[model samples]
Target: MEFAGCSRGSSGRALALAICLLALISLSCAARLSASSRQKLDVHKHLNRLNKPAVKSIKSPDGDIIDCVHISQQPAFDHPYLKDHKIQMRPTYHPEGLFAENKVAESTKERVNTQLWHVNGRCPEDTIPVRRTKEDDILRASSMKHYGRKKQRTIPKSADPDLANESGHQHAIAYVNGDKYYGAKATINVWEPKIQQPNEFSLSQLWVLGGSFGEDLNSIEAGWQVSPDLYGDNNTRLFTYWTSDAYQATGCYNLLCSGFIQINNEIAMGASISPVSGVRGSQYDISILVWKDPKEGHWWMQFGNDYVLGYWPSYLFSYLADSASMVEWGGEVVNSEPDGQHTSTQMGSGRFPEEGFGKASYFRNIQVVDSSNNLKAPKGLGTFTEQPNCYDVRTGSNGDWGHYFYYGGPGKNSNCP
Candidate 1:
């Protein structure tokens, strides 16, 4: 009888342990489900904030949805400072010595570039086109807050080569310093350079800089870029970026944030540009001009000769509220150096500057806006490259093209390794 009682006791203990284990498993699965629910809710809330109610929507061939949001209801007004801000319809003054773009030679006129979305439809006169953000776009980011924002320390620090190298960003640039600048202009050659990794990107841009190259740097950038991680494709797109505090918390790409106000209803930021340049083929390019309005103190951006896109409010910056200390123009590529070797991503045309002309990428007719609101050629222009063997730059000038440079190269050459 005593032996039988012991067996019963042992069975009782075993049953209790089994019950306890089952309870723990249930709790864990419930917790996981709750966490996943919270993430979905957060993503939806963010999408609601960014994608305002659209009066009309157009679907582009490239799988983009363009929402025509009312001007007053645009994202810029979401900022506390812009809550009561009055939109400036036009700049108080345009810089003199504008390029005669209409007089381009007939041979080069075949290189016209346009946004891919134009083939579908146009936004209404009183609305601005915004590229609608999708759930996958948010999920692709490391986090919701970092979506549509650049990683920190991406700028090329010309004064500190060591710091530039540590940042993993390579550049072939022409820069001007030692004087206050109001703005900058460049005609950038556009090409869809092959990106080896989704996280890496290639771009040709002009940087208008203020303050030192440290934590307090201010910058306004506009250019053409091919970033698969950012846009989920290899198509070259027109993009703009600004930062009042060196890209920490103050800015975002295009209109993903609430700082830059878009006044024009035609061109949509973040849309793909068609007719990219090909090697030894007809070359295509885009002209970007970013200048500060002397009277209003706001920074204005003009794309090509027709579209005066919009402006960054004077309140959005500190040092740039007055003038820029430096201007840089050229190509930059993110070199992640996968597998302990240089990446195979291409910058610009992915050909050395020595190739020249249609075979290489070039920035021509570079200019800077002076304090007197005049556009003039930069003085004492200097070039910089982190790894000359992997990428390089060469500058030249003439009566027709003014000041220009051919720059870029394949990243993972034998010498680069």
Candidate 2:
């Protein structure tokens, strides 16, 4: 679900002065607290509204669910962290498989499948609406003694902050790093699964990160998610999030923040995606690329074969101002077991990778941008699963796919539950 950023070192005296300066400067900008101190902030005050029944759920004319809670877009001038940041729409640069001939002004939803959310993915005038599920994610986690399955597990301050362990109930993932990475690319399959709760979601994504996870992690993420609170449907949708400091206040869903500039009119970050092969097929896949524009100092995201969406301005990040130190890809699912049983919702497809190629879901053509700005296959690909019976990953090499892997499994099974 998220990458725990790598750490950095600086001179003790210099670091002290920098922290003081950063605090003074960030008080008027985005002042980030150390990870330990950050969690102590009064998060309850910010999330209390989540329980209000006033926040109603409604349906769009197209029948898509809308958890009508619109998080007001913070004014650019008001964001202490990312103030007056650059946000814009650029000309479309078709990615690899996207054909200009098949290009449509609107998404395939208008022609091939049902249109959900905003027809063109446009939110209200200045308000950026996100899946109500995001709110649920925050509230649900906060309501618990332990953080929700995903968020609590990510922070080292939590009881089981270790991402490498096998206790399962993962908000878990695998990564490659120890160097300054520029970007990461992966082609991930999209699947819609049966969700058990309004707050539960199943996702598989790529995380390109700079800085360490504790206090100074900056990240750019993209992938497919079946999150009802956010999208209000069982249809898996393409989604993205960017943060200058961490996932807390600086970043949000797709264009929810005034940070990620959207250029492609054809694809919307959280809009429902109608995979060409449908949820049950092995053919549906989308290649995602996130790279830094060395010349412009901006981070860009490219989708599929053609749609080169907008970017996150460099000023919005610290480590990402130049390059990332780590890259991660894999699946994450919420184990919202009310009665202490595993959730039935699935990750990728509800099937095991042991089911074989066509029957199982996968990520292929995985690559990363080297410091030289080359799209090269990743080195040292590794896999991690919290529960072997609940989920698993198998890696392989082939000329066509490069560093690729097949991963997925039902959340509920005799051994898992």
- Candidate 1: residue 333 lDDT (0-100): 92
lDDT of 2 by residue, 1-417 (tens): 221232244455566666767768877554455643554443443334222222444444445444433233322323455554544545322223323213321333222322255443444332333333343344445343322223422421112245533223453355677777777888776667667777777788898887776557787888888876555557677788777665544666664435665545445456677633444343566768888776676788888656676677778898899888788887877766777787777777777776756667777777788777777777776666767688777788786666777777887889887
lDDT for each candidate structure: 0.90, 0.61
Candidate 1 lDDT (Cα, 0 to 1) = 0.90
Question: How many clashes would you count in candidate 1?
Answer: 0
What is the TM-score of candidate 2? 0.67
Against the hidden reference, what TM-scores do the models get? 0.95, 0.67
What is the Cα-based lDDT of residue 396 in candidate 2?
82
